[model samples]
Target: MCRWLAYSGTPILLEELLYKPEHSLIDQSMHARLGVGTTNGDGFGVGWYTPDGPAEPTLFRGTGPAWGDDNLRELAHSVRSGLFLAHIRASTGTPVQQTNCHPFRHGRWLWLHNGRIRGFPTLKRTLMLAVDPELFPEIGGSTDSELMFYLALTFGLERDPVGAVERMVGWVEEVGHRYGIDHAMQMTVATSDGQRLWSFRYSSERNSRSLYCSTAVETLRTMYPENPVLQRVTEGTRIVVSEPLGGLVGAWQPIAESSYELVTPGMDVVGRFNPQSAQAGLPVPATVGANGG
Candidate 1:
């Protein structure tokens, strides 16, 4: 499992989202309130885009706990961006290596996942065989989460993100079921093209890992009138996270299961996900049985 956050809108220092909150992602790295584990210290990563740079994002990832990393604190304070994705990892079985860290990058895209493939060793070979060869060499990690990212890319995630992701999940579940592993895929993924952000929350089982998004800045300002930080953000800013970074009640909303949310230049759009099946070529079933049984 892992903890992550994605931000889109007005440019702000990374610290504002990764450290300033009372229970920020760094805090969750040591004391998560809702994650299966209390700590997500296996490794961490952050990706951001700048105005003058190429469309590709700048990324920093390390195989160390976010809570104890001095470099992380220093970098968080100095970097600022209008869009970014940060992740704190809790390795399920993968080794704690830089290549295995989250916020995996491709050409102009960055991706991170918060869940796992229930039986990765048994399914990895098959899944790896399915990725497009041109995109295959770019994969730098052994994590199933990273594999899923490339699979979606191979399936055309950059062009039709929601469709591509749904297809990737469908393939995951299909392979899991083939191996007699029910509900083998669990995920809350955030992906960006240095412009728009797309996030998905779903598992073969109906009970997916927790994922949330912040309320509109204007709404939060009205709800917590006395909070000065809320006042600083513009009306269009939005944040999506694996958990609420702070204890600000009403500041976050759970994303619906079997759906995806899109964050563009000025607005956020959410809709149900329906991936066309690779086999039947029709909408695939996104539901899973209890406990993946």
Candidate 2:
């Protein structure tokens, strides 16, 4: 129900990915081809790391369509970073308030999600109770996506990101089954701790949301031998997004279902997801219609 992009590598002007591409994130906010909806106008947010600040990221978010936000346009043109996360929201049932927008932050970590819990309200209480009390106060929104972040943090996300997120998804599915809801979770999440970037694509039913990663810098260099921009980036640069930003067909590859990917300073690693045993014990929340109203 949303679109997002995570980038890591040589620092480049934000507009190169957010606005310059043919199918840029801004363009997707108005014409998303792969999202559940065609438009994700509810809100938008961006989180990026800079050399001058605390290792923690700086965030800019708004409760309006990204395409109409002049501030976002200006900032995207001027700011640059080696790592960044950007999201355009299509609220499932939450209010379109600024706090509810994504690229949510807590200390040095930043997170964003592109899917919803099938039955959030019914599960909210139980899920909220499960978050580590210390991290609970850092949650600033009512979206199930944001709640999911805190749950991962509760399970030690800061130390073992892949494991914690898998645990969170496992708990969500377990709760769904307890309520007789067949498929209660769908998500493609991206998180960064100002260094490595972690991303996942999963759903209980096996047909997860769309997630893609850019070609390896070496591969891109070989494919576009004459493109200077392609050559300017370092071999370690990588990008993960809900959809490809440009028409460079060979530049993106879809992430497999039920898998997680890790982008570090030197390499990109991908692996299968395994749920935690404890997660299977949580109760599923009751279901409700799509009246997100």
Candidate 3:
């Protein structure tokens, strides 16, 4: 439905990932091999943190194909960030407006998603009503992606990201069930707090979107000992994307179905993620724990 990339570590121009890679995000916008569509021309956005800038990341967005935006190309070449997220949107039955573009933000957090709710229009009101009234006004678009973000916030994302997400999804399924819809969700979502990056891939039917996290830079370097590109990116750097940017062998690892990942300053962590249906009364929204390598 869409494509996105999240990056951390080694301050470098945005083009390093947006345009320079063999199958860069820009290239993906035109020829996405894994996305449902070959072109994601509806809109695009990017948010990034600068060492000396404000605590909140800077954002740039437009209601046109990323590959055709002159301003985006110029900015990508000029701005440098160690942490950033970029998205190319393919409308999932939503109007293609600048406001609907992804890499959505609130406070210092940025978010993007790559799938759709199976029957969002049918369940929009019911699902949205569940969002905290205080957080409701912050929603700027009609896409299920944005609603899902606020849902997570309503469930306490700032303090418990994984748990909040589980709760959010659980609540969605709860609503969908009330309407007799079987597969109400499909998502591969990425979010960042200007520090750590978190990503999740899951679906109601157990078959979710495609997502991958970069192999550890140290391991890639060891595997491609003669490749200078491997040496250039630091060991702490990480990238989570909707698909592999290129055909670099051993450079990407598939995230498991119904799973989530965390990229912190110290290490990368992965953990199980399953729907915690309210009907089942499971302890899903509880503090979801993880293990790091």
List the global CA lDDT of all models. 0.87, 0.87, 0.87
Instruction: Write the residue-wise lDDT of candidate 2 on 51-167 in tens digits.
Output: 777767999999999999999999999998989999999999899999999999988999999888998877676667677667778888899989998888877788888888878
Instruction: List the candidate 2 regions with Cα displacement exceeding 4 Å.
Output: 279-293
Q: In angstroms, give how far residue 228 of model 1 lies from its true place.
A: 2.4
| TM-scores for candidates 1 onward, in order | 0.93, 0.93, 0.93
Give the range where candidate 3 is weakest over 10 consecutive residues by summed lDDT.
284-293
- Clashes within 3 Å, all models in order: 1, 2, 0
- lDDT against true structure, model 2: 0.87
lDDT of 1 by residue, 1-293 (tens): 89999999889999998998888999999999889999999999999998987778999999889999999999999988999999999999999999999899998899999999999998887778777777889888799989999888877788888888888888888778778899877889999998899999988877888999999888888888998877777888899999888777888999999789999977889999764554433222233222232
Model 3 residue runs over 4 Å out of place are: 277-293
